[model samples]
Target chain A: MNGTEARTIAAPDLLEMCAAHMRAGGRMQMAYVWFPQAGATPEIRYLASQGANQPFALWCCRPQPGEALPSLAKISPLLGWYEREITELGGVHFDGHPEPFPLVLHEGARSTLPPLDPRYPADQPVEFEAAPWRIPELGGKDVQLLPFGPVRADVLESAQFLFFYIGEGIIHYYPRLFFKHRGMERRFQGLCPKLGTVLAERVSGVGSVAHALAYCQALEAAASCQIPERARWLRVLLAELERLYNHLHYLGYLCHTTTLKVGEAEGRLLEERAKQLNAKLTGSRLLRGIIEPGGLRRDLDSAGLSDALEALRREFADYTARLERTDSHLDRLISTGVLTRKVAVDQGATGPIERASGLDRDLRRDHPYAAYAELPMTVALREAGDACARMQVRIAEIETSFALMQRVLLLLPAGPVRTDCHPIAASEGLGWSESPRGSLYYAVHLDQNGKLARVKIKSPSFSNWRAFPFTVHDSNMMDYAINEASFGLTTAGCDR
Target chain B: MPLWTFFGLTRGTATTAWPASGADNGQTGVLGMPRHYPDRCQDDCDACAAACLPGAIRVHTEASAGARLDVDYGRCVACQLCTEVCPAGAFAPSTDWAFGVRARTDLVWAAATQTAPARALSGMIRSTFGRSLHVRHVDSGSCNGCESELQALNNPFYNLHRLGIFFTPSPRFADLLLVTGPVTYAMRAALVETYQAMPEPRWVMASGTCAVSGGVAEGGYACAAGLEGILPVDVYLPGCPPNPAALIEALLLLLGRAPQRIEGGRLAD
Candidate 1:
């Protein structure tokens, strides 16, 4: 499969193509399918995985008029939502989706059609209907539903589940959300490419680098622009640093919640030290404004890079020593929220969560992007899928990320940070990167005026949310908080 | 009962006696009027006006003098961004944190003409100390920055409990309501309910620019009005998001320990 080789197939043959790709031992890296309302036709393009020996395979297929695209229920039930979302956004209708409703964009809400459609106007009043999922009521002699917050007493961006019990055990857990919905997706439309970076960074304040990098990759790909080698290396450094900090913060939160005082203290110290190092390197403790399209806004000096490396080494040793002595902390986390390997795969969980569940899948290694292709990465795995298993995976990944950062810094190439990128004409492209959470996918279509026509960002949170309910099935309700904390799911990332 | 108890009984008393002391309660002075320096002006800069989330700073430009900056301390939330971003270091926050006055007119002190007056509480030698305050916090739809720092008060560093400030879970038990965020439409009723539940002699302390004056979310449909529009706010601690130190000072001022002035820079112990 070559880049120039695009195979066009009828809509009825969409599922057959997917089945064929799977049989050929090809993995679906990303799939971007769109249909103009006027044309009422679907165009499917995907980068399928062949073996390591072959280049990335690209395939394009379209359904003929009055024909239906194949359903995903045959391949996997999880693909149902993905198919429905593509249908709702691009006006493509799937023949046999078990459930089909708008995923991110609200139903009936006014939105621009696919960029290829000339008949659809830009802005219109769109009304959105609420999703039709019955809120499960736990009915027992004493069981009741308790909604904690869309507005919480604490200053956190999430909802809580309280399972009212007589004394020690929980009866049911009710989940609530939509607290801080700033209408980010609606605002992303018609935004200039440069300003999109700011929007992406705010998607998840903690996962700022990941979101920005993914968005930049999409923009770069669409415009056929090349980022400098030095910038690519720096981008990887920032991404890995983000991953390290997020994992550290998650571990600290888990410790704090579980009443592991020493472990909590160590986690806090690691976070503070990491933040300070990040500040020294990027001026902002959160590493904002560091990543821009084409490359970075500023380059790291040798002295700054050296200081970061030194700080990393010092903190890593201290953290590792503290982790070793804390057996009690490990006891609380292990076997807590045990997601079985079968369940993890069925739910399509990714990142540390999937890897912890004995699934050795990592975008950095499986589908290499940016500097990851050249850098060595070891996929961390644990069979437990419990809270402790997740923590172990994160801990291992942090060490690996630190090593990768050190390697990148030692082999620092001399070049410019940014490349002069020209605006791209009307074209569509898919961008995928491994965010700290999981695989982040962005599908973008550029208009003739070089403005963003339509963008569908499938953040890792979207896919990972499905796995949460399954993990809490047999586990006690009290452990749910620890389970969620260990996952470090950002509501902002998911909501956006 | 142990051998160590018998040995420890031989130690002297930990109490200490000092010189004859007055009934001097450890209270800091009030904030003073803000001052401005002309030399620190930057070209085409009106940050004092822009950074004023309360819309307190008024910038006037004439043909000869270029730009003139004036701040209304009454409207100011004391966020200190003007001082923080002043390129010429012209805007100085006065150490005189206390500026308790009977009338609202006395609160508005111009920076250019006014001299730093004597501490406001120095003249009032009162025998009466205020009662301990019970503060109730309400989230009126803020960015959570204010609430984040506010939560830090419970931490070991800024132990708000030591300052006679207790956060009540219910507004009924609260003597003061610490409201953050601009009053969103959804939160307006809750705000009113919380304010109504508090007993008489009750005071409201708007803890951020959003609470005092709708900071960034001013004109949104979600926002109703600042805390003043719903309840009477006695003290205002301003910042895009106020630091923990500034928050501590504001709470202290409410308890008659610290003074309220438009001073900029670091808070002295």
Candidate 2:
């Protein structure tokens, strides 16, 4: 096969070949069980992308319905969560799943019937329920489990967490998630592609632009439509601004945990300023209503955000300097909630988390989506896997985003920002973008009528949260707030 | 460090001088709720109605006038798509973020419709808690759209504490309960329990379109169409998620500290 070819393999050969690919340093990027028709059987597809620059997509599909599906997660433990999601939504049992717990569905939750299942009855009530939080048997008898939040202290999104501790030092924790689920995937089942873009924006308010961009890219791919050159550059600009606002919030909150009130205020100030800039450019602060199928709903370059961006650059330089001068702030970060390189790679961690751990994985550079192909990308990397290293990576990325936004504004190719995109029919397209937190992958399947059949959104938080319990292995409970803040994981993104 | 102290002192008072000092309440640059004009609406026009994604706009045709548009501000996301597609100048664009009102009916904007008469509040309760307020914010099931704006209320820019409003973690100390999200079924019991925990005469402010009318996810499997059926809402502040200034305006209106500035989806004089 060529450098970028995807070869579909048989079910029996999936586990063996996938292991072979991983042995050659490959990663299972995204896995989803897609439904074809109302009465037709669903097929499990695994997107296997390996190699740094010389990359080729190897997508494996298990075609047979009645046969025992080979669980690739058995070989790679990181694939367990995705496999669990596939099993729950498809209502199919994997042969040898290790952690076969519920990932999305929970107790007292009643959602759509397994739309993929041939025997799925429209009237059948599939109760989405979960048993009591199973505290893993660990440490000693003195270790007590303390429950925290569906309604929390500061954050907006909702998710319950069970903390297991012997004394003050935290040991183990289980996140009882999915409280913010709007049944997003089930709702996108038959929406028109145009309306689907609107729904995709709400997946995570913080990552709205990236999600909508990803969804739109998938829509364009399904329709075999190419958006205008100017729209590509505009998408890049909006995505960079989105990253800026998100990183500003992430950095601000992390500093706030250290009782740095002034820094927190400054962070929020910068965030609001960025939102104002976004509103001026895209007509929405969160960068919504701009990203649509085929192109943006409006052209941002015409809005002339260049002068405003230049001002941001000057302000950010000073802001970063003032915050960096505080040695005590750095003291709280160094060696706090450290994630090892082995765990980050083996578990397929992404975004700043992976970059902080020196994994050198970024969808923007490796996958080259949108206008990224137009620019020379520098994927920031850090050797240290601690909180300080993570912050360093993020700050460095924020600086880079400032420069990137300027580049997008200056070098933007002149053309139409949109083109006519017709309804797609019976096609599947994969959309991946480097969101503020990390890589966002969306697998969109269109029905014969070109309506949205299914959309599986893969958030970077999903992968990063798996490493969270591991990051808190030896850190003090007090330092946990700062540690989690440094990671800056969004529960809304994860829940959706 | 002395430098840190210097920087802190140098950046004094970034707060907007609103209400007391006549600051621009963020009405510039951004577009807000759409204003509907019945007289100007063309006969048999459904362009804006069809363009509305969340079904915020509906057309009711009469024999005399032919077509009339009714906008449910509760369901309106303020994406301004209706303004973009309206053939006639009927659905005009507005930057009206100060859409906070005492009654839920104030959110709906039917062409040629007048503002609903304000309902009388219990005078004893209003007299009990006069001015300074303690707010208990519950993220019933928001995507964090409203929550983000709510957080901004504490920033140096908004500086909500100066206005006598603060967020209390415990429902016990709260005078007003601020609710976000479309009120998912899983969160309904918790919301009820929190509401119960609050002292008597506690007012609930539904802060986003989702909490007001479940914006896009309205009537989904997991949730109701916002806080309508769940609790008696004292104030309905509608937007996709109201901006920070709007939230403040809503809070002030709830406390009788500020007057309702929007009537029938238009800025009142």
Best by DockQ: 2
The per-model DockQ list reads 0.08, 0.48
Give one digit per residue, the lDDT tens place, for model 1 in A344-382. 766667788888899887767876767999998888899
The local lDDT score (0 to 100) that residue B116 gets in candidate 2 is 48
Candidate 1 local lDDT, B1-269, one digit each (tens)? 13223322343321112111232111122222345565676767886676554456767655455336655454554434466557777676553333332223334433333433334432231222264667778766555445544654554334466666787776677777787766644456556876887776577777666676664444322344467568776666655345455676666666656554443321212
Alpha-carbon interface RMSD for all candidates, in angstroms? 9.1, 2.7
Candidate with best TM-score: 2
Docking class of 1: incorrect
Tens digits of per-residue lDDT, candidate 2, A17-42, equal 87898898887776778777776667
TM-scores for every candidate against the unseen true structure = 0.69, 0.94
Quote model 2's TM-score. Answer: 0.94
| Residue B233's lDDT in candidate 1 | 64
- Clash number for candidate 1: 25
Off by over 4 Å in 1: A1-11, A14-75, A80-133, A160-174, A302-312, B1-269
| Residue B44 in candidate 1, Cα distance off native in Å | 14
True contacts kept of each: 0.02, 0.36
Error of 1 at B100 (Å): 20
